[model samples]
Target: MSRESFDLDIRIDPERQRVAKQRAREGRRLMLLELGVAAALVLGFLASGASRRLKAALLGAGLASPWLLVGAYLGLVLVGYALAMAPLGWWSGYVRAHHYGLSTQTLRLWLADEAKSLALSLVFGIAAGEVIYWLLRTYPDTWWIWGSTFLAAASVLLGFVAPVLILPLFNTLTPLDDEELVARIRRLAERTGRRVAGVYTIDLSARTTAANAMFMGLGRTQRIALGDTLYSQYTPDEIETIVAHELGHQVHHDLYQGLALQTALLVGALYLAHLFLRWGVARFGFAGPGDVAALPLVALAVGLFSLVTMPLANAHSRWRERLADRFSLQATGNGAALARAMTRLANQNLSEIDPPRWAVWLLYSHPPLAERIALGSEAPA
Candidate 1:
């Protein structure tokens, strides 16, 4: 976080970079392992007497209401998944973060955030589950179409509310205080014809050391936010380089394009989930498409579907990222500043400068740091 610029190689330290890379690999493996554990539990419930007994217990309790049954069913799934993944979650989320020197949070604070997130997920999940089941029951013949439509709309609505309603839950966001830098950002916004609602700095340092800047929301909700981590560590131009890349996203209309792409993909993913769930119901003893017991079937099917489509998602993301980088270069005309900023970000975030090609194709959302830096030598067209 020194004011002076530092060489990326020296600052990151080769040994530490190696450790971070190894941690990255471990983190990915743990993710797959967690999914395996979840699938296993779902399979266990479906394949054993437990699923029927649990359903029977609910019936015996006079909670014969379908809505209540779906709620309770998903609550059980959430509890099971949390318990089963607890150790792996701790290792991957807390242990690995601390080991890599990324986390600045205490265990208690981290747990508090996790608990809040879990509570939010549970509330939203149960409500969404209830709706989906209702739709399936009401319109069994074309529930997939309804489900996809509802989900696509929900995703877009979530984006509109995320800045104000969702983001404040975890981090404090205050208007960026540096007058000079604020002026610079506003100037860029003005020139680009992108009206920003506000420029804010998020309390990113409270949890992690990684620095970042981004544009969020759409229309009235649209704004730019810089992590306090970025403010503390990076130069003004470097910060501009980052923010400009985000602005590029806005100027290029990537948000709307991305949303459209996402909606199309959601429709496809939901249809696939529907098909898989139907296959599952026939293959197993689940009651029907709307049956609460089939929540696991839906989850596992969706998980598999997402994994199968990830490479496509990642490739599209990388393409958008490259375009953004090129846009930033032209907008700011500060390739050197961008290279420096990217280097520092990579080191602080423990990003591999150039990850394995397979990982890039399968997982990376942004181009590698080296690839970005190489853009420094090209003339913006």
Candidate 2:
């Protein structure tokens, strides 16, 4: 939001720092609020003996038809989750962006987007849950392996289609009109030996001031996209550094690596879910994992697993991110450009330049800005 603060020197803006600290505080609150709400829903459902009633209600609602049953169950679950998450979603997803002067959305527009998201999630989640529950019902003993494999495939499929299908639902994607930057990007791609399909710009200024670029899609959909915010707020050299960094991700096959690692994590998480479900259904006197009523328990299992694994995942991510930084430096052979770009990006995004060590260990998926800046200034081999 403060384009005037784009300075190469590491000068601190007191006002921006104040807002960033406030944002951080509020962000922590949002995270804790979300976690508490999720846990409360899970525990409250379990404790209030509501699960059985919901299951029975679904049975009656779906008594005459199979589609009716799945529809009723899925509808109830999705709507319930949406209702529970709405307040926090507004506070974090909508209000916070406005508070930070990052958002350009009206409340009505934001709510409409939220509704569309809920609808999309409901459709896909129900479809997937139906098959997953069917697997659990048919192969209780070995469902974890099959379910995980299915999920891994689904994840890949989502990534493949997301750029082409889902992205357009929220924002308009258009070609960047800056020929000079586009040419530089093409040259960078050629230097990296990657044939990027095209470079496009997403209309991010309509929604937020956050600057971002990424290499997404697979095969035909593979291309680089820069948020419009980036171009408006950054110089050609800075954008080039971001392009090189993202291209480094593609050259290193980080996407596939990330997918594979996530799949591995899913397999383990699902296996643990199986164990938890087995113990839970017996102890809590609930229906089997296939029952819609027990979905909350499933969520709990996966959620807890992710929480426990957060630090490890963050560490791996930060390591790979550093590798990407080093790759960018090597490819560009302009450490000063990279460092200055990194600095401007941090200032533009109002990123916490140097977060607490413990917070970085627990939740950060990328290395601290200071560390990344240092990488650009690393001595040549």
- The sequence of per-residue lDDT tens digits that candidate 1 reaches over residues 308-334 is 888988888889889889888877888
lDDT of 2 by residue, 132-191 (tens): 888887898899999999999998998899998998899777887787888888888788
Residue 351 Cα positional deviation in candidate 2, in Å, after optimal superposition: 1.3
Judged by whole-model lDDT over C-alpha atoms, candidate 1 comes out at 0.80
Stretches of candidate 1 above 4 Å error? 1-13, 377-381
lDDT of each: 0.80, 0.80
The parts of candidate 2 lying over 4 Å away from their true place are 1-10, 64-67, 377-381
TM per candidate = 0.93, 0.93
The TM-score obtained by model 2 is 0.93
Range of the 10 consecutive residues with the lowest summed lDDT in candidate 1: 1-10
